[model samples]
Target chain A: MSERPPVPVITPGALARRRLHVMFALDCSGSMRGDRIASLNYAMRSALPELLSVAEDNPEVQVMVQVMRFDTVARWHIDEPTPIEEMEWIDLDAGGETAMGSALAQIGEALDSAEAGPRQLPPVIVLASDGYPTDDIDAGLEQFFSSAAATAATRIAIAIGSNTDLDTLERFMNSPEARLKPLRANNAPDLVKSIKWATTAPVKATSSPTNAPDVASQLALNAEQLEAPSSEVVW
Target chain B: MSWRAGGATAIGASHIRNKRPNQDAFYASPTQQSDPRFMICVADGHGSDAYYRSDIGARLAVEAFIEAISWNLDSPEQINSLPQDIVQIWRRLVKQDIGRNPLPPGFERAPGRASDRDIFEPYGSTLVGVAASEQICIVVQIGDGDLLLGYEDGTINRPLAADTGLHGEQTYSLCLDDAPQRVKYKAIKRTETWPDFVLTSTDGVSKAFVDDAAFVDVVRHYRELVRSGEDLQATINALPDWLRQVSDNGSGDDATLCLASRRYKIQDQ
Candidate 1:
């Protein structure tokens, strides 16, 4: 067989390839200033290598990322589906009120706008906040979950500190089938760990070929302290 | 005219790196008991550490499928009930395996005897199969694999409908809580014409494409090659390498492809 000429096979283009989208909604409001936002930025930047590791680990999926920041209002910090290789995290200055609800609406719209469905790996959304939303988070949840594509996404949250609204964060992390709670980062170490877990676990759970919607829950069950406590409540 | 087939499976790039088992299995058999009889099956084992022994589950699925179809083929009355038979045979096989390979003494348990069905979690697998004779084609499935039949007219039909209840990587499995109820079966009568070609593949093959349409076109391309006189044996021989490339670059998951073609005699032509 080795001696014979190479045989031909069908191959699809990049456009035809499956994609895994991991969207991040960072709270850049005033409370996230100082150690909070700094740690958030540092941790997020450090997560790039691990995320790259995951994308390399699963060659079949094209990992695309988009970042959203909500202060007085929500807007794309890094808009468009940027391939992981081309991604570079830019630090943000915290200012204004928490518009997390608007952030959700925006994230929902992004998922809605995609032409993706079964061919798309269910998206992983991480909501990082250190404070309560000044906007109506409930309405945002309703709007986000209203989109079937968004509803199926693995939405998770990272609580920056003690002041963060556990109730709202829980609401955002809610799932009809998965019992995932927020990942609280008390210090820089916890921030790094939570960020790494958020970046890797969801990709591993969602990218595989035969996983259930609650695959993340199963992973969470095995992980000893996937949801252990208090962040200084950094933004 | 009669149908003949070939199939191949390749381990995923990641599975190899992780030292994990192939976890994908396929089976095909052609028999002369009838004028023309053919059968093919593909099963995908669930991934992740939770389903640790899914590779064994997938292997048993194909084995059970062949046993069930072969035993029931002669009994038309019992053939329609193959969904139950396949699952029953598969569970029984799992039970027997557990008996022979009993867990180590310290293995954790719920402090009671878990029935064979209740303890079948580690063996979860999704199966799709087809049994065909000159008169009809019987298809049965409980998961993500697909079945397609193509004729000379450029029309291709998927005999087993997509299960809308499933989404993304989620699928019904032979080891689910209610596998039999979820199993779907279809028997298509070959009254109009015999399909020129038939293809059955694991979800990995389809997941590699942008959409279902693109995957179907891949099958169409293969059929067109056959129509243009490319040798069947050559294509079959190359299937392993082709599928390996697909798994390495296309889906990064185990891939399986099985196909058959109708051989025509002068009288049939």
Candidate 2:
């Protein structure tokens, strides 16, 4: 009997793809009175082009965008829609009390809703705010991050402008690295680009379930590497 | 032909554009249809406002976006690379179509004058759809609405988020003042172990399934609803009366839904 040479085994690379359900839990408190809201509008307008571009390229990936604006309470600007490419922005109005708890609860409910599908690959929640909670924040956050409904989705927070309670925000994300510090938007252009980055950057793979750990290590390593050469993005 | 898991593509729709006499503005397309790959879904123009063209707007938006994705047909790229590229292109195309900003010459326009049957103004409508293959499920949207999924364990889930806490707050709408930059998406990859059902709908239909906690329960309802071997339309029509009940007595906007599942096809051996 002739013995055949050992056949080689090959395994294809596991495709690392994801479904993005971006719930923008924004603070539309009266404090966010004037240009702040306008800046947000400008930011959303500028960012849509980029958002549409990305959705077009990755057909497997869909985007479900819901805007939960909080001021005295939480209000959604749009119902949940995947591939939010056609999303029209509801210009946020700042009025009423900062019922942060209610806002958080609303977001928690949204996160918990039957409409918000359970994410297998973990959905990313971006909570952008500029102030401290005037209500029972811990309870609301507990509800927000509770593993009751979605055990896999990840949460990321962005604190824009000052007056933001970084410590509280840090607690909400459960990770310091996920927190995006405030960037000063001096002009309309600044507002647009900064908002774009905040909304779009997290959609990238760095914070993804499959890439999170690698991303964390790489970021640290990169930080160390950069520190070796006097840390600063001179370019 | 039919690539969705459920064999036939399921759709649930409701219209509430008329509270007045002599308006009579409502429409749906491919009337009674179920083709998975090349399906065209639309919500018509509510012919009463200045943007009386909105029905056309809704129709055009869904058609335009759907056609764009269907025709692009390129290999799916890395998740990181895809969303950005698609967003950029879609933005350009939409603006160009609106005529506020024109693209370089030769890109196709709907054809005929703005007054023609297929041609209309920057009318508006919200759309959410899914074009799925055996290997991929792509969900698309242009407005406010719900999209839910049923998992293997009889759980129901909505990919879209909803509002909560405090009364009288506004739910988001795909209306004129929309914050386009705030637009974003979450692309999730399906694994052999994860769930395999998709439910896409306009905000009206979506709100019906929104508040529940256990996604599995929702899925259970969906599974139970389909046991009769009914067509997609009838099955959707049988949604709980609350789901079909008009929030504003048929004076509200239209509601639409598209449900697709991923399952093995029982072909004749």
- TM-score on alpha carbons, each prediction: 0.90, 0.39
lDDT of 1 by residue, B19-81 (tens): 788898998765222138888889888887656778998999999999888766666557667
Clashes of 2: 59
Considering every candidate listed, which one attains the maximal TM-score? 1
Q: lDDT score, residue A158, model 2?
A: 49
Instruction: Please provide, for model 2 over A27-109, each residue's C-alpha lDDT reduced to its tens digit, 9 standing for 90 to 100.
Output: 78876778777777777777767766655443334566777778876677765644576687667778766666666677667
lDDT computed for candidate 1: 0.77
Q: What level of docking quality does candidate 1 show?
A: acceptable
Model 2 ranges with Cα > 4 A deviation: A1-18, A114-119, A148-154, A176-190, A206-235, B1-269
- DockQ scores for all the models shown? 0.45, 0.02
Candidate 2 has a TM-score of: 0.39
Per-model C-alpha RMSD: 3.7, 19.9
